[model samples]
Target: MDRTAHGLTSLRNGVKTLPLAPMRDNSEIRTLIDRVLPVVDEWREHLTVSIGRATELTGLKDTQIRYFEELYRQDRDPAASSGVTRSYSLTDLRRLAVFAELLKEGYRPAQAAEIVRSFADAIDYGAAYTVADALRREGDAITDGFLLSRLASQVIFAAQREIGERLPDARIIAMFLVERRIDGVSAEEFVDIARDIATHPQNVLVAVDRAAVIGNESDSSESVWSDDESSIVLFYSRDPWSVPVPDRAQFCYYRPPSTPDATVVFMVESAGYRSIPPELTVKTSARDHLLDWMVRMCLSIFPEFRQATRAHNYRYRSDGYRLAHTRQSLTRLMHRVRDLIFGDDADVSVACLLLPDDLYKPMYLSILAHAGYPEARARQARLMLYGEGEGLSGRAFNAREPFLTLDAEQDLRVFGAQDERCKVALAAPLLSHWDTHPFGVLYLASQRPASPLWSETAFVALVFGNILSELLGRWWLTRLRRKHDNLLHRYVAEYIRWFNGMDMHGPEFNEGLQQIERIWERIAVTSASSGNVRTVVERLSRQYVTLVVLDIDRSRQLHSRGDEPFLLAAQRHVHQAIAQILPDVRGYWFKNDHTLLVLDGYAPEEAIVLIRRIAGRVQMVPVVIEGRTERTTVTISAALKSLSYQELYDLSHHDREVLRSSLMTIIDTIYEQTRGCERTIKVFQHGVWEKV
Candidate 1:
């Protein structure tokens, strides 16, 4: 007889003899030992069994056995000879058994393979040490029915039970099948039924009414079964040799009360089983079902559909409904993505959206959500965009790409020095919609160093970053428009107040008002011509302007210091200090060590006095350069220029030429007086000024 046919024949013969044996404990032990010992002996010495024996033992077909062997071979070390004929060891047989069992339980081959691989190492170790030693130690007494069953349970079901324990979904399904077995069926027989279901095609037995069976068989209807109205159809394969089928037909199997629930067991070609329906034939896995549900959920929230709804004017609901729906959909998507990537036990310390300000500094980050941290601690979290060169978020922003560190303490250069909370850190740049350069970063941190979120959350975060960018962009545009409108409104209101303040009924009031209107028109024209509002406004508001020349004393000392970095920093500090004192004053760096300060609404003498006070303050404050404090004073020289509305209005058309000539004369006299003087205070009065 053909080996393949012989293996099938042997399996059939074994099934036939199962019922013929008497129900004595000794007989049961003798029966199991008779079936199992020979197979054990074959693998005991060399730790391997022939493919045919493995096929018969696992109840897997020849092709299925070959496929599993191929998978095992791929997992083996590449150094091993590929030309060697295929063989199965105690380890290989256990994995094969699991793979076959899952297949029989309606899992697709790929799904079964993935699940089996998860526990394959554990199963191999258990088989080698636990089962092999037990078989050798027990010897002939293994035939004692109880001892035989116990050994079988330990060796055969140990890995499966461990797998079930690790995965709650699998445990629930196993418990349902075990608890719902027919009355009088022994635990051993029920286990045999489960094994058989795993090895053969079976009828799917969904409840006729899911509501009626709720909370009875499974915790929830969605757990083990899917339902549709009119009839709760069970999906199954008609041919015993074929793969488990997708949900297509209502297949029912009739069994006596003495038989296990056909809903949970395979339909065997025996006296107790009768198949009733036969159209279901293609295979699907739990993962496939989940993917299908995810697809449906994603499709329901299509952008086109949402856009159409947002554009439509509905009488029943306000426009806010669209925003509410978008938020709801995004929340759902976040939850789903989290669940898929992190599993149930993941702890996400924080999720933040980092944005850049107009200065290109990452000043702060907006917290989206966080877990495993107290509300106070979460609220206290601060992210500095600039000068945070040592952190993962900073690195991501600088690099304009994603960054991940599994063990932040050991792997990261920044953040780890001061922070003990972060174990895993991941950051992905949030790019602008119009450009490839990143405008912000999406940051995530976790206490669990080994969490998969570091690797798995990058792509999803990129997608989310793009979505957030689009949303924030829309909000910013609206805010800018509102600000522009408000600025215009304020300008109009100020103009009206200036017009209304005039005494219209007084003598020459009309002429004065007409002159003011022309001045206003000149101011507007100058503002438009120069593209400077502050310049035009100042010229309109002030009759006189103070020009103060500030010369840093011994500034050449900085060049002699020979430390470029320190010198640059010290210069910046001085400039910043001066600007801080008079924030509204327009100033320019006329030279490396000199600044020209332009002040409106001050006379030359008053400006000179003010400049002296500012100079004293600048000398009093010391600047730190490379850990050393250094003090520097400024020499002050002031000049006053009259810039009345009438004068400005007349000069408006000659704008640059007249203003340049007037400014040059004032600047020249002050520069000449302050040329070689240090700590000098002088005021220009009637073209020539005296030193004070």
Candidate 2:
């Protein structure tokens, strides 16, 4: 997985180690133009010289062509005035060329129009809705061409969305064009890509429900129940070698009854035979970009925001206060008081007094008068919530040093008042850009008295307030820059997901590249581009040198041994042996109670020795697989030159057949020789020849 491992070893090395294409620039735009001009010239008649010419050739009325042209034109420029004679640029021309190719490939004009339109929307919006809308509008405007176009366009859009959702930026989307080998850029191919991406662990891309992260529960009842009772249930039915099954995250506890109804009851089930279960497809597929953003917000941006919000609500409840009203009033009062005190510009401060007009004087008096007590003050704070008449407001000029007050009672003469009843406060000068000395008093107030002791809560609040101010100041300065970077990363990651048709956020880049190679094995890239020979070769070779080792009669014995531990121990021995030799050999397989492999990496003579060693060593001791491993090799080089999946399959089948024949022939020969030896020994015992 090293980044530098796949660098250029030679100029002629056509296989580029799947670098995610960078976002296109002006030069790439020019390259696209160069690729499309020739197509345009050849399809000139079908395309027409201008919008007017196209209208004439297609026999469409002026209005129809205008509608089509207008659609294309508007998309070209968002700010352009409608109905202006906006010319089609090279990019537009190239897109038209692709549409023309589809038409020639048998799409009707109307269908072609729909398809082109949908594709345009998908490209422009990066979603499938645009195409869906266009089809809906096509209502009864159907044609063979239109149908083909519609199907093609619809498929492309869906696949693109599927891919784009996984990788959200532009470059990854473009890279998909080059990497994915789906048939004719169709939707099914994209779906296949999406499935692969979803299953591939290296893709690291995950989707989560945003509502769930925000504490919103799923509306479905199944979400709260065990999976067996839910829509999908995980179970084991067949051995791993029997089929290529999707992996599961864990084993199932509730095994369904062995009946056909069981499968119908559970929409999905997963299991493993000689290996561990595979990953869950549905879980991975459900994860998308919004969820990714939520995860980043929670884990990356501010981990404690959600927790703090919850904790604050709990604190309010525990204090016998209605948090909703208290919070609402607090917020409203903060803004209002800020405006009243600071006028046009209000600088944020560590602490400020927020009080209703009616209770201001009473609360202030209670703090400094004979009624001053922590219990009484706390009660008055709650009574203030009940709306009452307003209190008097006054302004004084030429005041001395500013002393803090709870509400309206401003008296600093009695030092004993600074007890639990009247929480102590600090008054620091607020200086702004316009002045150097104190412009206004900045107050810090807490519930704990400062005479001789302070409450634990008050001390904590003091520390918290200081941290908040410093943190907020730093946040204000870097918010814009952080937002920009986050946005860029989001788009790029998404674009790559779209390009690969899978999430690639899980592992580092190199691991993903290896995963991509694994998926590429299952698909065929039809693009006649360079650098695909090695990939094709690797895929074909897998089929040519495949080996299949049949258990012969050991299935029951292994089953009797019981549980995964024993089976795994046996499997590990075989797997380790296979793994060590496969690199030196050509092909290998492990499934069911059989070991099937093909060797093309080594010469025939060398392959013989390697295959024999694998066969002989596998049956060594306590883990007995028929007490002897079978070896078979077929020369596929003559028949499988231009290799393919099907051809590889045929080659493997052919080799297995030949191996079966060899086993039968050996068995028959041994039987015949033993029969003759038995007769000779019986005759010798009866003294037919000399007894020496």
Candidate 3:
């Protein structure tokens, strides 16, 4: 039997299987049949086309038609027996017909499906068996097939409107159907076609979705070849429109068990669809586009630096290296700016003022040559805050304003020979946001008399100057921090080294400690007013000093093979812990095994308890060593000593060994008495110390 006959038999069997409610009279049944017969007849006339006929009419292969057929059938009856064949309706055929046409017009399968669905939803077929009847009822038909064509036109127009609204540059091009395993066309050929289309300046975008062949190793038996395998839709568009297209297309596909290769139904532009005007698409202006590109380029070169809070009192001394790096960054930026505003042919020179020590005294940064002038001549240019200088740069710096001169030789006096060679000169002060005075002045000069300096040129110069000002400010702040850190480190080093050579019996012992104390006090008053340094210094000076020596118990267990980083990290962890727990504590690394913490202002008993607490906290936390986390256990011994001038003066005459022995005896006795006691703390009072 023919496929249609088989479908009819299935429909009959399906109807017979339906459960019927008990009816009171035959009239009710007749009334129901009268009402439903027209709709059923309509479906038969439009939707009852065999799968073979569907391929012939819609230009979709058999497999492609089956894909859509299965999608609709499954959607309508998800739990129906899987092996049974289902019938396709006119609704499904109409949607497929529209989708095929859209694919030919260069719409992706998914996009075409969306358009077809929207068209189907928008049309009202009330009581009409055919599209022609529907059009007649709406009074839209002018002649034979005219209404159908017009309806197609309306659907296409709506689809175009949707595409145009969402994607401005994309328009219908062309689409058609193909076989997944055609004789001459291979996957590589399809890829090449896509590449060729993409290369076109106007063809900005391209997309292709292929059907997976049934017999292919990649295909699984469990795969439902419904919306997944029918159509391969491709879309292409011009430049900006060529950006990645949105994935909104919805096309159906099905792979029959008997078919080897999946049917690839596609769409491309043809003569039927109306042409879209090129003017309707958005086109960015060249100037705006260029400016955008320039901004992106600038940002890539100089990313904005985010300043983190200062966590440690240490700074790197790399001023020379930092200055060189800053110069390189500024030079590249200057060249970019010059190329942007003044063309390469123009005799442009750019230089920045250094302002080494004070802002008022400006020196040459010497990054770029001064406007086709020798580097030495540029270096010679300098400015004073109040002095009357011959150079235009000096005048600009004094006035704190941009200075522009048409005749450099006549208007300027400093750098006499060099000024005579330049016809145009422009100087703009590099003003910083964070500072009251300008950091430096940016100078630009052109030797060519033909190149006129416009007002816009001056504006560009000012802008470049401001950018340099901000960058310079960051560099200056970094320099100041390093200088401050170096000074602090120097004083601390001097104090520590000075103690090693001191004799307790000498008169200078008391005087030397007092002098170091005074220096620390001056630093606290002058520089570190309220930060970590100030807190540390105040604590050290105000209270009796307690020395707590912490020795890592299992230091020998640390990995010996390239374990430097692990050891350093462990040390940092300990230091950070102590600093967090006791903000006023000052400590130093002694040898490689231990750290000596100087806790100030605490009595002997209080000092011992504080040290015990610090040790406990450190031991409880785990540290990562050799890629493994291990608890840090340490043995601690502490001794408290007073640094009073009178006590030190009396002890100055005592033997050095006796003084050291007395202090050691006190610490050893305390450790012995309270080795593991939690509540009781061993504190060496003056009486206990004297007895020792």
Candidate 4:
């Protein structure tokens, strides 16, 4: 998935990799006037012309056209406007021209006007609500940092949000400009895969969900994405092979006539597939600007923002405090957090924190980064979720200094973890920016008791700890920058979602997404905490996502009552319960306390059914608390938020901002409603909470 983000296509069978198009300058304004305007006649209804030009087309004086309009209006037929602009269209002029012809044939002005109204039946008017208008409007309205032609930008925007409205999956479109062949599948087999997905989608570009990352999660190979065609698109080039095209394919070969050796795309009915007219089609008689536009959009998204937002090259694993080890996507400084945190020094009794908020604070430690270590010590240091001032790591973080204890076994401060078996322990603070708050501590304990080399080892650990701190500072900066860049991508998507059916050729059209991204890049060019893309996407869309929170009621109290084992067992049961209920619904677990499930493509009713099923499982499964068997219902909070459009929303801040807000509101409602108890199932719908 390295190249998968921002529509950068993954290399697969018969997939040719070409550098995508860059964002073009204001010269793009000419694209509409020169190419699409003259060619895409459907664009004419959305596009408007001046009155002087209308007069020229109709061969009538301005006064005469006004007189005809007045006569029609007196009979309650006023000329229509383009909505944005009150200007007339070529259709109006053509209608006028036809009316003048009738007048020459001795018909009254009212009769001529009535005759002009049936011009579509009399003349060849183009398709309405074509994909071209969507493309043209999205492209023209969004003119900044956008290079792909109006056609391409809209295509990319439409690829999922609009076009996917008709599609079966959230397929990512990757453009190919060169002829290539599928390595294993023959042309015929390729058709079968597209027609039926009978074989693995390895032959196409599919984007598997993070759930697809399980079991084989450690395998970060691009091949894993082939499991689902729901989000992959292998865009082909024009006339590249003799393979028969699959009906209703997610992708089609496209090459604009402006390219040097651009040959006509043989069978691609890019626009016709959608029942749009030929002139308003993507592979219309005229098309290069569209190629540019698609490339622009697929460019890691203005992919120059890749220049502005340099974190795209790194896979994100840190959002919402997710941990990473060797090969997991983390900060560049700790490109391999496992090396020092869980690396070669594995045998030396090393323990690292889990879920460090901004510095790995507020959590526990694990010494065995891998399995099959000494079972006794492994169990001892398995996990000790403690308070901020409890563990030696927390002590170092709070005091802002390294801690070294030569006699670790008898040190009461060391806690009774198996690591206390060691004679010496060293702990150092993993520093944060400005040293405001230290988040995590890196701790080490010796396997041997009271060795003379312990002092020197402590000093070396202190020195290396500071070095890691400096690297983490850089890592934090990179993260915030990446966060902002990601927000921009969301804003672009949000604005387009709202603008899909709107007129782009109208006056007063503001390129909100483009302008915002441009201003954000310019303004926050250096700040760690920059602009909020969430705030900008607020009014653009009311995204439809169901937020579900499942937690063990009174988890903190249960943990304090020596119910750690109970809570852990409950988590396993909940995980099993979900797998049994709706295995395909991907849910993200947080801090082992609660599970955050953002359900996309699932109805609120189905999600509630799932919650009830999970509640049944937790209530049915007995756990030993205080050596007594008891079953308790878990606390479940669920809400379904609806949007006006279709979007492939995921679990990233990009799509989760609104969900996050609603999640907070959901939690808040539970706090107020369940003041008397800890367990309850609450669903927020139609602005009311339903308790089950």
For 593-640, candidate 3 gives per-residue lDDT tens digits of: 345454544555666666667666666766644323344443333334
Better of 1 and 2 by lDDT: 1
Off by over 4 Å in 1: 1-337, 345-350, 354-362, 366-368, 371-373, 413-423, 433-439, 446-451, 454-460, 476-485, 493-692
The per-residue C-alpha lDDT of model 1 at residue 685 equals 56
Which lDDT values do the candidates have, in the order given? 0.44, 0.30, 0.42, 0.42
Off by over 4 Å in 2: 1-58, 61-576, 579-587, 590-593, 596-692
Worst 10 residues of 1 by lDDT: 313-322
Better of 2 and 3 by TM-score: 3
Give per-residue lDDT, candidate 1, residue 273: 30
Q: Can you write out model 1's per-residue Cα lDDT over 626-683, one digit (the tens) per residue?
A: 3233443333333333344534454434555555455455455555666666777767
Best by lDDT: 1
Off by over 4 Å in 3: 1-321, 348-357, 360-371, 376-386, 413-420, 433-435, 450-452, 493-692
Q: After superposition, how far is residue 661 of candidate 1 from its true place, in Å?
A: 21
Model 3 worst lDDT run, 10 consecutive residues: 303-312
